[model samples]
Target: MSDTAPKQRPQYRNISVPQILSYRLPLAAKASILHRVSGALLFLCLPLVILPLFALSVSSPESFASLRSYVDNPFCKLIVLALIWGYMHHFCAGIRYLCLDLQMGNDKHSAKKSATAVFAVSLVLTAIFGLKLFGVW
Candidate 1:
């Protein structure tokens, strides 16, 4: 038998809070986390922001005009833009997850590609809607 010793495997350890900030997550993991965040944002805003605005807008002509003006402010526009991004990202990621459930793109390479595609498509869609919202024509 040879005298050489077998190589030891690297030890795996739990990441600490400080290390977490600097730790690099894989693209698919990042996308999955963001998907959860966006879903939460949508769920919370539906009750807090969207429902209130819809109720006010449909209440009366004056309320509708006020709502329109409120939405026209640059600050409000930015918030709307954020909501647009959240909605788009959540929708794209949801579809990706559905495909995953169906066993599509189940491999590592395809998973990464789909994650990248989700980001790209969501951002592109958000940009298009943002341009319209800002009256960019």
Candidate 2:
């Protein structure tokens, strides 16, 4: 065989980055992402909001009364509602993850259904708890 110069492949410097808005991710991926977000929210809120309020509530009778009154604030109510949602979503998604880890819902259809169920259960539970929090029950 005659040795000649090897052909070099052309290197095109154009790199195309796909637009995020045009990318459609599956429901299960969305649920998984939300699970992480909810967990983070719960973890951050525990020390910043809940613990301080809990400590104040148990400090004395006056403090408890003050805390009770504080809960009546619309802003505080909204924060509590958000916290409730975080807890519910985290709890439901965690259960879903546990089931997944156990090899349940491993199939595509079952995985989608389980993700949907996690969303529904968490939202429904949050709604019920929200109603009670708002004194509608």
Candidate 3:
């Protein structure tokens, strides 16, 4: 007869580490955030925000002239210019994400490169559109 109970075994425990935030995240992550934000801006610019533009287009010469006088003001021009930037930025960011979906420029390095390119293109397009708007081009 054994003097004591059968031998006992030791238990082991599992451990996990918490995720930390850093300067680096994936390109897809950055692009995803930008896309949603830009979409929101573009959405808000619809309806009443675009009414001024419509008025300028369809009203008679005198009415159109009034609309122009208003928009041509520095403050009004600045606001419209910002809206133009929002539209172009959103559009370009959407395309950048599409390229990622196609598995193009998916690498970390190439992704950063394309992201910068997206903003540059957006800025250029916004400038050109603003010029066209005020008859500067």
Candidate 4:
């Protein structure tokens, strides 16, 4: 004579949009998100900003000088810096993804380490390029 009862399972709630700000995502997730963001940014900027600037710069000597003058502004420099960062992050994250696709760093710890490496390497590369862009010796 034994009584049997169904065990209750814990319910999981979906986080609301506002709750996302407080949510602590794992490093790999954060890196993946940023990878998508950087890719999108590069895609958007390629035609809108980069192509026009590039065409202007290479069109003529006067246009090249004009482009140089425009880029001499601190605001433009910051925008270029942002673009550099986007490219750097995208490149680093792309490599990380390639490694993932090859089944490298598939474990949790390795994935976390690779994600951290992506961020660190991207930032470091961006910093180096930023310094060059800023004419820092």
Candidate 5:
């Protein structure tokens, strides 16, 4: 066969379900993308973070007590916990992406490793803070 005789190009248009999921993409890829999204959400959620600090720092003892009481309430506690998860997830994911930027965890296995690291850090942080918030720590 001649080199230029009816050369056929390979087709690259097929996709499979499992072929899509574990195709060996980097762990840091999804983590980094989610990190950016979470960071944006946390930024947009500033009033929620700042208001608590402001309420705690600037108010009188009684006012702070009132704020504390509200925070201690179950509904507020859950909301605060969700915010904590948001912040912790963003922080851990950010660190993972930073590692990726340093050329670490860019492979599929390494990326999964980094993602595991992200979850472990986020979970530990959440548990610590969660217990503290619930006065169990």
Candidate 6:
């Protein structure tokens, strides 16, 4: 037997911390995150924004007229436009998710395409309605 013991093998480990923010996320991941964000925004706005506006608009003829005029403000128009974007994005993304759950477009390339399509459809819809909202048409 040799005086020296057998040499021990060195152990290697993966210790690098990933830079999540700097990393480029896939389109599907980005859309999924935005979907949740838009949903939360709409949910939050429901109690604080839409209900009050609806109540005020239908409370009486005087209130209805005041509410209608209130919406004529540029600030109100912008707020409504934002809400429209939230709604359109949420709806389109929800459909995308439903299809994914059914196992359609579950592949990597298909998922990316679907995500791009979802974003395009949502933005196009928002643009169209936004034009109408701003009285461009």
In terms of TM-score, which candidate is strongest?
4
Residues 56-127 of candidate 1: C-alpha lDDT, one tens digit per residue = 999999999999988999999999999999999999999999999999999999999999999999999999
Ranking by lDDT: 1, 4, 2, 6, 5, 3
lDDT of 2 by residue, 1-137 (tens): 35696877966475456555556988899999999999999899899998999899999999999899989998999999999999999999999999999999999999999999999999999999999999997
* Per-model TM against the reference: 0.88, 0.84, 0.67, 0.88, 0.70, 0.82
lDDT for each candidate structure: 0.96, 0.93, 0.78, 0.94, 0.79, 0.92
Tens digits of per-residue lDDT for model 4, 69-107: 999899999999999999999999999999999999999
Let me know the TM-score candidate 6 reaches against the reference structure: 0.82
Report how far residue 37 has shifted in candidate 3, in Å.
2.6
> Model 3, 7: alpha-carbon shift in Å?
37
| TM-score, ranked from best to worst | 4, 1, 2, 6, 5, 3
Model 2 misplacement above 4 A: 1-18
Q: For each candidate in turn, give its C-alpha RMSD to the true structure in angstroms.
A: 2.6, 6.8, 10.0, 3.5, 5.7, 6.9
Q: Give the TM-score of candidate 2.
A: 0.84
Counting clashing residue pairs in each candidate, in order, gives 0, 0, 0, 0, 1, 0
Worst 10 residues of 4 by lDDT: 1-10
Best by lDDT: 1
lDDT digits (tens) for residues 2-109 of candidate 6: 769898895648444564455698999999999999999999999999999999988999999999889989899999999999999999999999999999999999
Model 5: how far residue 83 lies from native, Å = 1.1
Per-residue lDDT of model 3, residues 10-128, tens digit only: 45364334323433666546656766787887687776578657866687888878888888788888888888888888889888888888999888888888888877898899889
Give candidate 5's error at residue 78 in angstroms.
0.5
**Greater-TM-score candidate between 1 and 5:** 1
